[model samples]
Target: MKQLISYAVAALSLVATQAAAAPVTYYIQSEPYETVSNFTACPLGGCTVKYAKSNRISGSITLVAPLGSNLTDEDIDLQIHSFSISDGQNTYTDAQFFVDVFAQSARVSTDSAGNLTSFEFKFDKTHGTPYGEASYADSKAKVSYIWISSAPSPGAAVAASNSTCQFRGDNVNGNTNGAGCMMAYDTDSQGASSASTTGVTMSLTPPPAPTPVPTLSEWAMILLGVLLTGAAALNLHRRRQTA
Candidate 1:
């Protein structure tokens, strides 16, 4: 009987472990858009006064890992198990976006001392057009990219020495894409332009509220019921033996 009870408890333990859910979250707060620089220059195509802008967006980007998977701080490139964005009003899921943002593009960077330097999240939709090829798209398929770093500061020219500023996830082959983490939300034929920013803050999302545990009295009641059932079974076994 003791052995049987032990086996049953072990089975319950296995089931609980299998049914458990583990998720990781990252919190992102964006800075307002601002002008980075302005200069008068004549390009090869035409003459114009050009300026650069940093990335700034108003929304919450939530990233979740796959079930049964373990994600650690040391993991350089992370899989985009689940992705969503909430723009203070509506939330958009991965299905709404034309591109699969999870193809090993999400990454975290650290310094030599293993201190977190910065991290970036890249996702965009070009209305079925191959990413990077779509200069413009509809609202549902608009292209969007977000990058938040620690160095060079927002609205400042990207530091050449700041190697961690690169966004090489989905777009590989040394594509210098998503520079300065500039965000664009334009839905016109002219295409969206990157925006400048004052600064952005990032941190680990707080853990969800913990489930309440049973009180000692409740646990005692459960234990008493189990003991009674076991005792009844033992008593029946003894009677059978006597007969």
Candidate 2:
């Protein structure tokens, strides 16, 4: 009996330990578009400037992973992978205006099973800046790209604009025809760590376990009764043989 009780205690301890180390889940959300300004050199000599305009192009992306996984919040970098802009009619591509935004570490909470009960991604946009210039034309430029673990080096011709001329930049400078505007990439890239951002913390609580129909105590009592009966029978047979 003493041995059986010790084994049960050991088993329960193991179960508790496994429960505390379960897997966790996390979610990601991104907002890509923000306002930016473009400058142009005057047709004759002086520098021409177009005040930054508000580009309403924005989108979101979500990713999931276990709690304390190999992936870090810093790995959640967002680059203007690709994009295109439109002026209510025609659309153009802005391939060179790629930028990298760094994401802040995530705030994570887990349950007994080590599963991620909740998570939030916070990012800083100040790290991002324009990479290359576009041609001076009057068409909407659209660009697209990916958000990955690290920043990528500049590449060859990203995409083409509607310009009849093969201009390297996305034709951002309005030509004599007054057609210079950029459809830049907008996204959120955040890093993760053990700390929390915004000075505000978030928490996740696991749902309560369902009640058992008969209860554990009742089952335990029934098992004890069966064991006692078997023990009594064995003792009676031993006494009869001795007599």
Say which candidate scores most in lDDT: 1
| Tens digits of lDDT, candidate 1, 138-199 | 22233334444544554221111001111223344223233212333222123333334556
lDDT of each: 0.40, 0.30
TM-score of each: 0.41, 0.22
TM-score of model 2 vs. true structure = 0.22
Off by over 4 Å in 1: 1-21, 36-78, 86-92, 97-104, 110-117, 127-144, 152-191, 206-243
Candidate 2 segments exceeding 4 Å error: 26-104, 107-243
Candidate 2: worst-modelled 10 consecutive residues by lDDT:
188-197
Best by TM-score: 1
Candidate 2 lDDT over 44-71, as tens digits, reads 1212212122212122222332344333
Cα RMSD for predicted model 1 = 20.8
